[model samples]
Target: MADERLIAALDVSTRAEAEKLVTQLGERVGYYKVGMELFYALGGDIVTWLKGERKKVFLDLKLHDIPNTVGNGICSLLRLRPDILNVHTAGGLRMMKAAAEALHSAAAEADIPCPKLIGVTVLTSMDAEDWAGLGHTEPVADSVLRRAKLAQEAGLDGVVASPAETAEIRRACGEDFLIVTPGIRPAGVSHDDQRRVMTPAGAIRSGASQIVVGRAIYAAEDPRAAAEAVLKEMEAV
Candidate 1:
């Protein structure tokens, strides 16, 4: 199951590319992340198609709003019944709690299992200076830890953080709290737009329950080989 934590991000714009990646890496990856771009273009059909192929989907909408609005949004998303979902921890404890409760309630009423609710601590695009510019004097690691704790307290299943902060988050949030690291770059891969990055082995060693890899795999000359390499690295750790 630990090996299955490598989520290959299908960052393609079209369904053809998405389906091709799924076909190539689906056996190696347990879950495929459907982020905003693909979700916006294809809607729930993407999740449905993935399920048809026996793949668990993580819908990374990162929903954020007032407590009532976010709760309503989660209630709606619950109908799609993804394996996992996420909201921004910056949404505050009340919003997070409300969203969780509403999702659980909706799932119960619909006779469906509730999706594991995760929280997004900070975007992988930002760094320490970015946080400082946002009026946060604390280091990026400190800020991530703080948000992760808040998410756990509000009953979230885990948090999405950079791989660099996985160890600190694990130490602060406990072993059971899932840490999904997104800034994973395989060896020799370009960092792209992500600021905080780590290799697959490094991410797993840092205590990541799952690692979200986008460009590193999708943009590779041989995506299947790239994914397999990442799996081997993770196994080595």
Candidate 2:
């Protein structure tokens, strides 16, 4: 199995909270995800700070826009040179392809390794009913599969999906297509805003290449211990 201990989302509102979590679990986690919350507060400097501390970063802005606009946005983010980045697959093939091409061009220009670009299929917070309301006639799993395939066809590195759909996505997209799941709730942790969640071991067993956990680690009384427990669970799987 690939190292499943990937980006641990620091879903805080300030640099201090993010940095504290980084200090606690930085060594255990492979990458730290600076999502909209923290990124909005601290900007690209957060990524620069994490890099300065020798930690890989995943800038999860989930950029979505027209092809040209999204491409420009991706180029802006590529300048930061994060280890990973993502865009909503719903943006269509042209947007995704443009983003991918821009990322490669930016990396080549900067003489840096291109960041792995993943696609967000569906927010884990949404369910079958939510999709149905949005006019999706198929089941949630089917929709997720469709989006994953679209992302793969668009030349994305992989997708960010719920753990429940990871296995199916793996089978459909092939073994090497990265699966980064976020709706992970350890055995006793609260689910919070995530609706489709699984345990770390279960996610790994389902063939998820990487897991992005937030509250299960960040909200724990001992964040480092929580992160270590997750690593142990991943290793066990």
* Top lDDT prediction, candidate number: 1
TM-score per prediction, in order, is 0.96, 0.96
lDDT of each: 0.89, 0.88
Question: For residues 1-237, what per-residue lDDT tens digits would candidate 1 score against the true structure?
Answer: 425688888787789989988877757776889999999998888888988888888899999999999999988887777888999999999999998898888999999888999999999999888888999888888888899999999999999999889999999889999888999988888888899999989999999998988888888888888888988888888
Per-residue lDDT for 1-237 in model 2, tens only?
224365688899998888888888756776888899999998999999888887788889999999889888988988787888999999999899999888888889988889999999999999888889999898999888999999988889999999999999999999999999999998988888788999999998998988998888888999889888888888887
> What's the true lDDT of residue 56 in model 1?
82
Clash number for candidate 1: 0
